[model samples]
Target: MGLKSFLSRPLAAYTVRQYQQWTRQPELAQQRILQTLVRQGRATAFGRDHGLGGVRNAQEFQQRVPVRDYEGLSPYFDRVKQGESSVLWPGQPLYLAKTSGTTSGTKYIPITKDSIGNHINGAKDALLHYVHASGKPQFLDGKLMFLSGSPELEEVGGIKTGRLSGISNHHVPAYLRRNQLPSYPTNIIEDWEQKLDRVVDETLDQPMTLISGIPPWVQMYFDRITQRTGRPVGEVFPAFQLFVYGGVNFEPYRRKLLESIGRTVDTVELFPASEGFFAFQDEPHNPGMLLLADAGIYYEFIPAEQFYEPNPPRLTLAEVELDRNYALVVSSNAGLWGYSVGDTVRFVSLRPHRVVVTGRIKHFLSAFGEHVIGEEVEQTLREALQQFPEAEVVEFTVAPRVSEAETEPSRHEWLVEFARPPQDLAAFAAALDAGLRRRNVYYDDLLAGNILAPLLLTPLPAGAFQRYMRSQGKLGGQNKVPRLSNDRALAGGLLSVG
Candidate 1:
């Protein structure tokens, strides 16, 4: 038998046991977790801040701490990175994981040693999930390629240089000193510079079996690999068995990726962050499971429907009801408490706490499984509009709908309001369609046939999102334009009729 089958066979018993426990006794599992977090909170920064928030302990955690978005902790996060104790949390944090924010900047999120342990635990769980699903440890053993932000530390020797690169330098993990592969270059890029070269050098003649990174990079890497090898990836590297990815949706690029690989390759979806590894797919086919790191974090769920509601019910990770959609709330060793990560999720089942990542609660879009998140869509649109000397995004909203009810499958429509209407709307829309198709195959297929009609960019009046913000009386503090909204209603009633 090949390595994958061999490894999987031995681990079958353990995987089944964990699966049973995960699928059964979810309530008891939650209660057990609640008791653990109550104790951890008392020892961590979140517990200390709870008193100020009027939460004396875990029993009163809900009452004491209110839900918070990332903008709420920006200042405190800055302080924590400077090695200062933050008012938002209990203690002095050790390191910061630099990550890009939705707005026009990168964020240095605090990551304590305790939270780092959580990250490792999350990583182990990731391994367990792969082993369980594929029944193989060889996929874990071979040379692993991580297309992630570099592990380089920012220097504080003298004059401080500030740029996206410099900010990224600060977020390198302390443990990277001992953990990273020796062959991978020590110097890495701030904006994916030298990406193609680095990938070629590190992977060539290497025993790489699994690859992990953001979806775009992976797609790009595969494309480059195919070009260099002059054949599909299967011919270049037959040993490759698994592709693990996170930080962005994989559904969009699924088809092209499968075609490039030229065979069925196991995939694992990881939900990770600079803050910590949150959740991972427990089984390959059953969406992702929110395996509670009872020892690491305090998780809370706010219903997606009530996300913008002034008074939404915030359910602790353990108390969370299954088969319902909710916004993820996190409290960890990092100074964030009751913080909303912005991603929205729906529970698939509870015994093992499996969930489907529905969309981002903030600026994001998911029309017909394209999963066009804010940053990704923004990047694509920015690149496409660069060609249009006068084109500017005044505002835009994507809504999933039935373009033609008579059609067997409904398609998507993006209602976009431009700052300066494009000189050629058809060309502009076609550019976006091309980018989306190249980036994701599902959309490509949808467009090739009429499953999804040609993307229609409906221009709206200027100041759309801004107008919605004003009407909601939510303008100015730290709000960004919503990228996607359910077709039921205009997001925050932000769309102006064209």
Candidate 2:
């Protein structure tokens, strides 16, 4: 038997057991996770200060701890960075996962020993679940490539520090490491362009069966490979069967990626952040990802509309309703206590609790009091693209263009880089404007009242956003273009790149 087959027997059994507990008894599993976190952390400074010692249940835990963002937890992080122990968790973190400053500025998230276990195990279960669902026990025999950040970690205040991908690489198990591609030397190359070139060169001839990475970077890899080999990805690696991706919405890139591959492959989406691995596409056919309720994190959801309120209502899994946007909060083994990861989500299923990430809390255009979210903008583009079937959007960003004088009205400005330019630019823009108005009531009202002009569309040269991100040294791996911004800073920067 092959290595994968030998390992699958036990892994499959374990996955089945865990799946039952998660789906059949979600509340009980969540309660156990909460009690474990509280009991283990009760001795820490954060625990004592937040009355974790007395937090015996979910209700008590909620009443004691207030929801906070990275800024709110900065004071505690500052102390932890200075080499303090037992501040948030039982001891100092194993390393700090330095997140991409795409949304807010850079954040150093704690990655405790316990937290890393959750990440590793959660990933394992996701893959195992895929194997179980597909009934493809030999999926692991062929080479698997993870196009991720550098594995070379640097020391910051005596603690190891690097991107979350790098940190996870440091902990990759020996058995799985044998099947993973692009040697360790190639992984540690800090320069993204240099690393991509090397990875393409090294992995082109391998029997790659599975690939995982953020969509944009994976698209870049596919482009490079096609250029180098003069063949479609599936033609180069016929054994390739699965594509695992996360960190960004897959809608815009879905058609492009599938076209590049030249065949339909099984896909699994993940919701992993610096704080924790929160959810994964458990079933291949399911639309929403199954939340990892027992994955060492206690989750809370606040209605997106009330997220900015002084004291927003925090709801547990049972309290959340379907189709309502919510800002997710978590208390985890990673030392993040009631921390808002900043992304918003909507529940599609309540029984097993599946969710789809809607957008970022800070990524919205509300310059003219017409709040436009990422979901609305993306859906609008999707509709607009449908009208121009030949066109494909490479990347896009939206910002407000405020009036320079009273004669003009403020309007939403879109900078879109298309791989395949539409036949009619004006029609595409009109479709986008109409679609946006249809999606958002406030935007419709503003258009009707003449408070805001029709949305402006500017076609950017291809690779504009890529060039901008490269200049910012955030070209790949959890770094993405902010879809909606209140100001023109990002849009201006991308336009300035000739």
Candidate 3:
């Protein structure tokens, strides 16, 4: 047997066993994770300050550590950035993953030894689940190309700082590193356009079996490959059988991506944040991903409707209900105690604990009390796009247009950049408007009452969003366009572009 094939067997078996055990007793697994984190971090400043040393159970832990967001944890992060050891996690973090901030300039999320281990193990389990479910072990035999951020890092207060993918790239196992595409030098190119060119050149002829990345970036790669080779992606990489994606909902991009691939391929969705690796799609037909209960991260859920409450009730895995949107909170090995990651999710299944990412807590529109979310907008767009098969949406954002005078009507403004323009722009807008009203009762009521005008659709010139991201110094990596904003900052910026 080949070395990789031989090694994968035992690893796959262990992952299957672990997944079964954790899913079968999710509450027990989570409790054990919570206990481990509290015990391990008891010596840290945060641990002592929060009295984590005496916290023996989930209830006690919850009572001790109040739920916090990035702003709430900023004080401790400031200490960590100044090289403070044992401030949040034990000892110093190896690196800090920099994420785009809403108010602050940036968010520095710690990456400790234990947390990195969780990241690696969670990724492994995701793949093993895919293999086990599909009964396809040959996937390990070929190269797996991951289009991610550069591995090149900058030192901040003697700690490495860069994109999470870049940080994780530095620790790729020797055996598996050989199977991953895009050389180290190419990954660190910094210029996304140039980096993509190099990636395409390097992997054009490789025996690629798996491809993983954010959907938008992956679609860009597929488009470039097809353009250069004068052949579809399936023809270029017939061995490519799986496409793993996360960071954004796949619904809007699914049709265009499938058209690029020119054939059906297995897909796996992951819910990974700078905070932690939380879940992965395990079953082939399941829309929700199975939550990773034993990934060294304690999970908590607060209803999205109550996220802004002064003291919202926090629910553990056992308490989370199916089909209810909840804002996720995590206390992990990374030393983020009761940290809100800003994402919202709804449980699809309670038996094995699976969830679908509904939207971000901050990325919703509620100007007219309609309370439209990212999921709703994306689904509405997806249904709208079906009417115009030739039109492909590359990027989009929405914002409320409040009236300047009492006589003026308020409406929702949509800025959409399309790779392929539609034949009838007005029809596209009409379809989107109808879809939203049908999906949201509040929106329907507002429109029926004439309190809001028909949604406005502005087709942006190609590369408008990209230019904006570049101008903002957030062109690549995990940075994405805010899908829905209650304010006009993002919308105005996009509209200002020629």
Candidate 4:
């Protein structure tokens, strides 16, 4: 073993043990976190305005501070933007993580000194866990690459501001930073297409032991390399053994990614975001990510089915049950109080509090009362792929196309871009319909009653979705096409481009 791996093993073992100890008492740890947050919040301007002076527990906190998204809390954020101290947190924030989403146009999330460790250490601990479990830590020896946002940050109110990935770029540990790839100049290129070409040029022949990014962008990089060299990524870089991915589920892009690799490589899943790092896959076989209970963030859950209800029951970790979908709400040291992160998660294991990202709170197909979420669609597609091994999807989205006639019912429209189109399109569509019926009862019911016809599958030409994103100026590592939407806007957009 090299000095790095040799030293990492013992440290990994100790860290994992310590983490396991706290995970065993999740509620206790969370309660302690709540107390700290409440104590510190009393000193903030927003907290004082929200009647947080007497808040002692969850109920009181909830009553004093209602759940708010970016728009609802923009008043306080505006103050922070103008360099106001003690607006949200005690002092001025260390950085502002600027992110753009489909719903919230642009949001500047604060990341303070108290919360920065969660962002950095969460990633480090995940890799260390892999080092301990896999027992093959040579990934540290070669060039470790994180295809992320630019390290070039602009100043906002005397605070560094940029994408969360970019903010993370500035804080990579020195040991790994020495081995990071694509050079600083290549990463700062604003145009994704140009940056990707430069990335291909710089790392085509390097010893890439690990490649980390959102899945779609990583697939794009692999495509570029294979197109140039006529060799699979595995052959191109024999040392590449680990792929770390976040921001989206990996299953939709998994088959194509593995085919490009031409071999199996271990993967690690993370649940990091600009708000805070929430979870990471702790065990090799466990599909669910272990929730970071002791981190600077305090987590709450609202049942997903009732998310739109006026007063939904908010539950703590101890009150949560298994296999139920819930919207994630969090209070953190970053000055976000009762903040809705807009993510839906399902708990698969309560003992260690492991969760799977079900979907986005707003990104669903509920137009016809058949609320089909992200995880369901992704899983259904995975099943459908089994029947047609020749077909590999590049990207896809679903939206309901309502009928103009009163008697004629609408159908779900599926716009799929394939890396390799299936030979029999009708057969592929039937397979998808069958799989979705097995997973979602409401969608199945609609078909049974003739309220909805079989989903229409439009095999889009390759690069169609990428073109749409480019047109919107959102083609990059940080942006992705929504898996499914409720309205015809995205569907119309995709069809218009094709």
CA RMSD of all predictions: 11.3, 1.5, 1.7, 1.1
Candidate 3 per-residue lDDT, tens place, 54-96, comes to 9988889888999988999999999999998999999999889
By lDDT, is 1 or 2 better?
2
Candidate 2 lDDT (Cα, whole model)?
0.88
Worst 10 residues of 4 by lDDT: 98-107
- By lDDT rank, best first, the candidates go 4, 3, 2, 1
lDDT of 4 by residue, 128-184 (tens): 999988888888888998999888899998888998998898899887788999799
Mind giving the per-residue lDDT tens digits that candidate 2 earns over 93-186? 9999998655458789999988888888878788888888887766588888998888888888789999999888877788778888788999
Which residues of candidate 1, in runs, are more than 4 Å off? Answer: 1-49, 52-59, 86-91, 155-182, 191-193, 317-323, 364-498
Best by lDDT: 4
TM-score, candidate number 1: 0.66
Off by over 4 Å in 2: 102-104
Kindly indicate the candidate among 3 and 4 with the higher TM-score: 4
Which portions of model 3 show Cα errors greater than 4 Å?
Answer: 1-3
Q: For each candidate, what is the lDDT?
A: 0.61, 0.88, 0.89, 0.91
- Per-residue accuracy of model 1 over 1-498 as CA lDDT, tens digit each: 555446555555575576576446655554565555455555545456555434444547777777777677665555555555534345554555555575526666666656656666565566666776666666544566666554455532121223222223344344332222323353354334354566666676676677766664566678678877888876677778888877555554565577788998888887766656777887787765665545455677888767888988887656777656688888765556778888877777765677766667765455565555554455457667777857655456566665555754565556776646779999998887787777667778877876677676667676565456556543322233455654536632544423
- Which candidate gets the maximum TM-score versus the true structure? 4
